[model samples]
Target chain A: MEFDLIERIRRHTEVNRDDVVEGIGDDAAIVAVPSGRELAIAVDTLVEGVHFPAGTAPADIGWKALAVNLSDLAAMGATPAWALLALTTPDGDEAFFDGLARGFAELATPYRLALVGGDTTRGPLTVTVAVHGFTAPGEALLRSGARVGDVVMVTGTLGDAAAGLRCLAEPDASAYAALVERLNRPTPRVSAGQALRGIATACIDVSDGLVADLGHICAASGVGADIDAEMLPRSSALLTHFADADALDFALAGGDDYELCFTVPADRAGEVGATLARLGCGAARVGRIVEDAGVRVFDARGNLYEPARAGWNHFAA
Target chain B: MEFDLIERIRRHTEVNRDDVVEGIGDDAAIVAVPSGRELAIAVDTLVEGVHFPAGTAPADIGWKALAVNLSDLAAMGATPAWALLALTTPDGDEAFFDGLARGFAELATPYRLALVGGDTTRGPLTVTVAVHGFTAPGEALLRSGARVGDVVMVTGTLGDAAAGLRCLAEPDASAYAALVERLNRPTPRVSAGQALRGIATACIDVSDGLVADLGHICAASGVGADIDAEMLPRSSALLTHFADADALDFALAGGDDYELCFTVPADRAGEVGATLARLGCGAARVGRIVEDAGVRVFDARGNLYEPARAGWNHFAA
Candidate 1:
């Protein structure tokens, strides 16, 4: 029965690529990478009650699964190529599989990412996606290259996904359709990441909120950052639904925002911003890299700011 | 807490290599694939009650997860290189993580496989591993290359894992230590697969029963196979633990063998067998590819044989 459901998924999400010598229906997938190109690989898993609410749609779960992995590839400035999915559901839920395949295809088709191979098994609702992308040797972005006096920037708006989740839990909070959409389906900044390939000193995706992910950059690059909290980009939808303090808090520490947060040399900040603007991403220079060794946030008055929670920690909960 | 567990895993299983531009602690891992080599990728998932018994040790679970994925790579005649693990536990179980990491390192160290990038989530007990290997371009052994008159073969003894599983269920069933070990830690036939690279026409790993997996080769290659039940190799451990009929049934239809089922041309069967023998894994000639398009088994009396179950079906249970 699981095999039959896998066949259903295979039919809905097949890609024909010359380089993919073998796609599905094999013990393993065989793909030819162009000469001199390095492979960038990432994997992410989403659980039912942990990553999403229990009543979330199957299609939304599928989209979020691939979206999170693609965000990782984007953070590395790699071109998406292939993906493998390991899906577990209660028994063989054919309807759920169909909906999930459609959702996966919705995100995968635009990137030209092929679903090469994977496994389907019986268990709690979970989706694990492993994405493979290509980058020119020595060109992929890393979190360990941030230098002192660099400018910190972020693409898209923050706190929308977290706000969306709040709205999902409390429908009376606000009925902002756009925020809900952002929560259900994130737009991975693939093109913007490619645009910043040579410009950004270090990069990471804002998965565990802006502050925590940026802290990763500081730790890896042996540098620190000071963020101007007032400079954080906020969408009109977020402002309409949330008050200033709540929205700022969510933007600072709430997780599940699949936006790219990166650092660029102070001299190249304009070029990076202009490039992202041309791509229609419109990044914001929210902070600056410092010589200190941890992330610090300051309000508009230059006073240190703290939040109730830094970000989502799986075990801390 | 998840991050701390990941740190422990990183410390326990770190592979330092010049080719690995980046390893763990990154959003994605960057590895240089040598020029002129194609990558072979495969993924497998194991669930608590579905894939194994509930009380199985954490170390064994980790070993089996990586071993199954390596088996897929072995079936393609690919040399193991890197792997990504997505582990979901009910909570951040530190002891379980340590035991699992140790078990994973045991199998990974021999192949020099690096633990690259992955995600740790909070959910039911699940382990999903995606492995990446390298093979010479156009040299991967696929399941769609078997030809008529080719000799069907398998590496290692059959029925040991199945018989061992029985022993696990009923501890009173003949105390065969080897059988229990085979069920808990099935060795992946990587060396034998490499040895059969040019000699075998087609290949697949026996994760499902021999009949089911061989049937896959037949369906892919548009051919049939006829196996002689008497020719099936039975380990002394399996034979001592099970009666003749039960042992034969287990060999034919019981799963989890992790042996390579392949086909070599009739003229080169002797050469292929000699190569595997040199690799310390003897080959068994239990069947032959035919012009028909389904797998059939014949008993010693020359009559057709059928078992109660062809193999495990995840959803059927």
Candidate 2:
């Protein structure tokens, strides 16, 4: 039964690349990294209830599982290549496996990412994806390079996914299709990150809300950030579905937005913005790096803004 | 709380290598692969009840989780390099994390394997490890290379871990310290695999029963295998603990022995045997590859023998 499921997954995700000496069916997968490239690897695990709400569609879960890891690679300015999935299901449901394989393939086909290897076990539903990518030597982005005078920018809009989760809880809430799609299938800023390789001083994907993830950049680079909350980019969907105060809170602390939060020198801000625009993901400069030690936000009236929670914590509950 | 656990894990496993451009704490780990090397990657998942008995020591669970992945790399004749761990637990228990970290470090330190990057989530207990190793380009031992006239060999003694598991179930079963240790912390045959790179025609780590795993090699290589059941290697502990018939059953069909089952040319068998012996893991030849399709075992009376179950299956229950 396990072998048949593996065969089904293999058929769904058949990637043909000369560099892949061996894919699935072996004890380990072997891939050749080109001479001047370094391998960028990242792993993320999603529990049934912790990462997603209970009774979510299996296809959406599969898409989000691979999406989160791909977002990590995008933060590192790496090109997607291969993925290994460790999937745990309470029961071996054939339809669930079929849906999962289709969803995984839908997201992976565009990037040509091969499903190299993984393991399956019986337990509570959990999905762990480890993605491997490649970047030119010394060209990958890191969060520790932000400078005091750098400008903070974010791609696309924030708060949509968080608002979508809230809408999920209130069945009578006005359904915002775009926001829900954003929550289910996030667009990893792969090309945007690649375009910012030599331009951005620091980069991180906003998985743990804007304030908390930017705090990581601040701590790593030994700088602080001052954000103009009024300048935060919000999609039409988010604005239509939420009020001003609630939308601001969702954007600031609700998390689950996979947009790239990056920094560039003040002088290169225009160039970076144009580059991202050319890559089809326009950027909005919402903040600037400061010499202080922590994140600070200001409203249009210049009053300091404080959020109730910083970000998502896996073990806080 | 998550950060504190991460810090504790970081303190337990610290690796210093010039090639590791970035370690933990980043979205992705960046590692340099030398000009002539290829990366071998593998992943394995262990659930609470499926992989181990309930109430098992946390340290043992940690060790076995990593050991299984390293064994996969060993089968590919790759030197262990880095590992990513995705640990899911019902709750964050400090003592459990401490013991788990210690056990993981105990096995990783000798291989200089760096704990590069991973994720932690709240869920049922599960440990998924993705291991990365390097091998010279085209030097990997693959399962599809065994020829028709090759001799099948296995490293170390078999059936010890299976017998050890049985002993654990029976409270009155005489405590076999060595066998129990084998069941909990089976050693990965790294050195032996490295030694057989050019000598062995094919290689696979014996996670499933010997017959089932060997059947994988045969299926891949378009060959069959015939084994002399009486020549199967058995540890003194296994022989002392069970009757001859039961011990043979365990040796042939019991899983969890992280030993290398490989094939060599009939003429070069002696040289490979001596090489493994020098590496401190003596090899025993008990079978031969043939032109047919499936694995066949012959008892001392020269009659074919079959077992009720071929190997462990996650969904069988």
Candidate 3:
């Protein structure tokens, strides 16, 4: 059964270049480490109950497993090259596992990310993907690079994913299909991240709501933030679906937005904005770093609204 | 509860200056890419019903998950540096999860490995560990580098894990206590693996029994092996507990032996053996690589013993 599933996944992807040495179907993968590149490795595990709603589509689940790990690499301004999947599923259907693997392979192929190794086991539905990427030695954009007075920016919009989740929880409500798709299939900003390689002072992906994830960057970089709420990028699609009370709250604290949030020096902000525009992604000058170590959000009237205590905490109720 | 567990594990070992930039408690681990080093990464997942018997202790499961992934990194002759753990368990007992994490953290600390980052979820008992190690650039040992005339050697004893499993399968039986320990905590050859840095030609860790794992090395290196039954590493503890037929068969095909099986030039055998001994490890020459494509084992009377057709296929019954 595993063999049959493996065969199905193998058919969809093109194996280019011999540098992979060995791809899949081995005890472990063997890849040629090109000389003079720093390897960036990260692993992410998404279980059925914690990372997504139970009984989510296997295809979406597979796509998300790879997407979240790729998001980590993207935060480092690294170009992803290969991945290893350790997938655990209930041992019932060979075709189901095949579908999941095929979905993963389909997304990976276009990105030139080779599925070099994986392990399949029988258990509850869980997917752990380890990604390998490369960057010029010592050139990764870290969360510690942000400085006081650096202008904080975010690529693309936020709050869409959190709103999508709310829609999923209450599916009877009418909403735009694109918002729901954003919740299910987030596009990792790989190219935009690579473009920010030398320019961005600090970077991170907005996984746990914008406010929460940016707090990580601020804490690591030892800086504070004053976000101008009115300047946040809002999609007509998101505002239309959640234009009601506290819709802005979803944008502020909604997790699962796989967009890149980074900091740029004031002098480099224009160039970075132009670069992102050329890449067809919208950029928002949402905030600026401060010498203090607290994050504050201000409305156009300069009044601060109380932030919600809920962000996505897996272990908490 | 997670905080308490992390503190307990953190107290067991100290971090070294060479292996970490930031350890634990971060968005992701920030590791320094050492000059002239290439990173080797591997991930493995263990599910309750799939990888072990039902009702296995969480502590043992924790040990095995990290051990198996460490075994993979050892195969590359890479020095262990950091690990990320993804654990899914029923949320009823926070203590259970904490115990499991403590066991993993304690085991990892002695190897100079830090718990970098991980995700936890509520689900069936599943543990996935992603290990990251570093070796001098272009110096990692590969399974595909074995030569036809090289001597195949295994560090420490084989089949201890399988023997331990037999005891676990029938706990009331009169098996020795040492065999059970072997099954529960199969120590990976970390030191021997590091020592083989410049000596061994090709290496792989024995996880899925000797025959099945050596088959992997053989397929990768485009060579075969001729193993001698008389020279096989057999535990007297196993002999005392099993019928001759079962013991020998289990010794031949039992899985989960976390020992290093590597090939070295015949002329380097003495040096490799002496080197392992200096590190307090047992290095036994058990076979020779052959030009043929399949593994062949000879019994004590010089009669050839072919492995069973169905050898340790996890997907197959």
Worst 10 residues of 3 chain A by lDDT: A1-10
Q: Local distance difference test, per candidate?
A: 0.88, 0.88, 0.76
Candidate 1 residue pairs in backbone clash: none
Model 2 DockQ class: high
Per-residue lDDT over A1-317 for candidate 1, one digit per residue giving the tens place of the 0 to 100 score? 54566667777777777779888888999998887788899999999888888878888988999999999999999999999999998867678888999998898988889998989888898999999999998889999999999999999899998888888767464467789888889889999988888889899999898999999999999999999999999899999989999899889887888999999988888888888889887899999999999999999999999966778653242
The order of the candidates by DockQ, greatest first, is 1, 2, 3
lDDT of 2 by residue, B107-223 (tens): 998899888887887889999999999999778999999999899999999988888887877866457878889988999999998998988999999887799889989998999
What is every candidate's alpha-carbon RMSD to the true fold?
Answer: 1.7, 1.7, 3.9
Error of 1 at B4 (Å): 3.1
lDDT of 1 by residue, B185-285 (tens): 88999988788888899999998889999999999999999999999989988887679999998888888889999999999988888888888878989
lDDT of 3 by residue, B1-317 (tens): 33334444444434665545545544345566566666677778888766777776667777888888888888888788777777676764756665676667667878868776666656777888888777775577777788899999999877666767667657474446788777767788888888887788888888777787787789888999999877877788877777766666666677777889999999999999999989886799989999999788898788998655335543232
Better of 2 and 3 by TM-score: 2
Worst 10 residues of 3 chain B by lDDT: B308-317
What's the true lDDT of residue A194 in model 3?
Answer: 91
Q: What TM-score does model 3 score on chain A?
A: 0.94
Error of 3 at B124 (Å): 2.9
lDDT of 3 by residue, A174-200 (tens): 555677788778888888889998889
Candidate 1 versus truth, CA RMSD in Å, comes to: 1.7
